[model samples]
Target: MALNYDKIVLFGDSITQYAYNVNVSPFCLGPALQDVYTRKFDVIQRGYGGYTSAHAKLMIDKIIAHENTPTSKVKLMTVFFGTNDSTGPSSTIQHVPLETYVANMRYIAEKCKAADIKVVFIGAGPFNAHQWWPTRPGNPHNRTTIQAREYCDALVALGKEIGVPTVPMWDLLMEAVGWKEGDPLYGLEELSAENPLTEYFVDGLHYNAKSYKIEYDGVMNAIKQAYPELLPENVPLRLPEWASLTSPDVLEKALQ
Candidate 1:
């Protein structure tokens, strides 16, 4: 098929990769956006599991094509990262220095802006360690909610500094899940399946169905505020609506 549609590219980590997963108990982020846009824009996912901003910078050129390239135009790009990047000292591979993370984020925003792509950043970290710590695979739990919050806060400010819009996932999730700093965890460690956060998180990090819904809501709100013209409801379909085709001639004209 010809690439006949403009796209909304979701470029980030595992969060982006799983945005369209109906198996995640339905109500997925990417699919919700795609459904609303339908024929107007393709929702492209470029999420890399375990990738940090440094890795993203290392592979930037390959991930984003130049304008000279013959391909569908990318109307908007949502950069959702920072989960793994928020890892603590034990995470030798995933731990990106705060300054470096900021620099990498800047590089990403600059490149996309130069390409004339509308950008939005989604800061998806500063996770709940109470839920994630016990599920760790090794000697040290490499991430903590405190450390994640530091990185998430940095990204939010960085977005404002660079004129790119950012969706503050940490704060949004905290409010949605109703947990915050210094709040007593239900346990010392090892959260049960039915903790205060189970409704939104699968493992204290990855999102469950409800979290994706919250994400979709925030994303749509950001688009409506910053790029209202790009909102799915505001965009026109690539083809005429079926009910509008009263005759073969009308259909032919619409196709042209």
Candidate 2:
């Protein structure tokens, strides 16, 4: 099929990869956005499992170049990282220095701006230490709510500095669930079939369908508040409304 609509690219890690997994659940954020913007914008998923901001920084230019083709224009991009980057320094594979994380985020936003694409930065979501810690006993559990908070704050600060919209996923999830800092386990529990909190996450770090709904809400809210002009209601629909057609020549009417 010909590429016919402007694109909204979602670039991130495992969470983003799963955001479009209908097999996991039906509340996939990418599809949800595509449905809302049907015929207007194509939501592109560029999520790589276990990727960090450092990895993203390395390939962002090429990714952008590939997406910015003659037929497909990138209208907006969301840079969602920090989950893996917040891993402890000992986890050499995923850990990126906090300073490097900030720089990478800035580079991403600057690149998107240069492409004339609106950008949003999503902070790391809350990590359930209690659930994830025991599973990886050999690896140190350095990712705490505290560490995630620090990274989230840095992203927010970077957004302000660069004039980009930021979705404070960490704080948004905490407040949604009535969680407070210093609470035991950060008020998050390991997900179990019988546990009430299971609706929020499949494990401690990944979101379930219900939790994805919250995430979708946060992202849309951020876009509406920060880039209202991009909202579907504000932007023109790709085709003329069916009711507006007065003649049998639909294509002619649409072109007009």
Candidate 3:
């Protein structure tokens, strides 16, 4: 039988889904990880656009079971949600109550814990309503920075309570654009075209290459600190390197 590699699962909504090819660049988190982990461990993406925490909880079992088997175990999992979960009621079909969001997140952590997998939470990723407002001019705004922060903060606190480390995507992006706490938000289309927020965001909602680099750095740093053993540099390739083979017999033996 072929060798089965260990797994690193990225579970979340559209952000996770889009990480591989956002803005037509593989510089995003998913591909960056796979590049580093090419022969060490497989990176499995479970991103679902429009998925809420409740949806994540429901899907966790399948995700875990898919990799956390006897042969190929899941060593790490990034639970990235809350962007869609932060949607206000009557705004999007994916919205879940804050309390429900907390409960669902907890459920996902518990599942990963039971499987002996290390979990990292990435949440409440930043959003710019002013930049996003044009998408739905007359309709109710589906999400805002404040609401996203509400859920992200809750998730951060939840991570603390659950003893899991969290990567603060929302805060990092906000700070990148120099957003100070207690700053008043502008109405739709209020920001100047030259606003710093325009640099990291595409259409005020999706991330471009620059912002994705932030995400890649955050994930690598989190792993470097919390689970150094899983770092790409530290992990050995499962199979022998082709250049290391001395003879045809050695190569055949290594394969066997």
Candidate 4:
């Protein structure tokens, strides 16, 4: 099959930017997918830390209006927001009102579509309040786990309305069997140890290194579903040993 586009754009909050990193080229999703797309495309990681969908709208507007050049060649733009709109002291501390959030995303979708660029909305991933967060609202160990997921669901709805493809990352993380019995998802310790440089979270809100891998895999799989031609040809199918430990059913259903 022929390739789709020549560049990929990633826009979101700190978590979208891997939560925390300065002057770093490969922030998170950008770097992880860079290697995978090396032969065919360039990944532009436009991850601004601590931004809500409202803020993201401003930046994306600029890129679409100014930075995007017909001659430069950009094929896709994957957007992942809503995390900051839900949590963090410094954040707006309020869920982005569904209407406003969807509008911002729509702005992005319309712009990219006009340019013939594919738009993929990556629903924010699931997070275990007990492990990933320092404290829950009432329960220190665990608060309601599905609120963020719910916001992600709204994003999915918005994407569908605009005819944009969505990566159901929330479902992927929610369905995963925890690394251990007590934890319903992988714990920080187990995740951080995946690699020496890996730290599951910088605070309780952003990805370190290990979690980035998990996030990247889900998005890539999602992209493959919507645009198979964009993926590297002749890539072998292989699963990490530990990944087999998760629910097989979810693993078997290829992301689309």
| Candidate that beats the other on lDDT, 1 or 2, i.e. the better one | 2
Worst 10 residues of 3 by lDDT: 184-193
CA displacement after TM-score superposition, residue 130 of candidate 2 (Å): 2.7
1-256 per-residue lDDT for model 4 (tens digits) = 1232357778776666652343432355666677776655667777777677777777766776554665456777888887656543333444466567778888878878887777888776655443444444443332223556667888889877777778766565545433333543433333442322113445445565556666777677766777776676633333324556477655454321
Tens digit of per-residue lDDT, candidate 3, span 1-256: 2368889999988878888884565468898889999988989998888888988888889888877888789999999989888888885578899999999999999999999999999877677666777766787766777788899899889989988888888888877777787774432244453567767776776778888898888888888888899899898877677788878887677667
Q: Tens digit of lDDT per residue, candidate 2, span 29-134?
A: 8888888888778899999999999999998999999999887789889899999998888889998888999999999888888988899899998777656656
What digit string (tens of lDDT, one per residue) describes model 1 on residues 1-256? 2337888888888888887778864888888888898888888888888999998887666766742145578889888878888877678988998899999999988888887789988886436656676666665867666677778899889988888888887788777657666775432245444556656777778887888888888888889889999998787778777898889988777666
lDDT of 4 at 230: 63
- Show pairs that collide, candidate 1: 126-148
> Please, what is the whole-model Cα lDDT of each candidate in the order they appear?
0.79, 0.82, 0.82, 0.62
Off by over 4 Å in 1: 1-3, 66-71, 137-139, 180-195
In model 4, which residue pairs have backbone atoms overlapping below 3 Å? 14-19
Compute the lDDT for candidate 4: 0.62
> What lDDT, from 0 to 1, does candidate 3 have?
0.82
Ranking by TM-score: 3, 1, 2, 4
The per-residue C-alpha lDDT of model 1 at residue 60 equals 63
Q: Distance from true position, residue 170, model 1, in Å?
A: 0.8
The C-alpha stretches of model 2 lying farther than 4 A from their native spots are 1-3, 185-198, 245-248, 252-256
Error of 1 at 4 (Å): 0.9
Against the true structure, what is every candidate's RMSD?
Answer: 2.7, 3.1, 2.1, 12.5
Alpha-carbon runs more than 4 Å astray in model 4:
1-5, 19-28, 88-95, 130-144, 178-202, 234-256
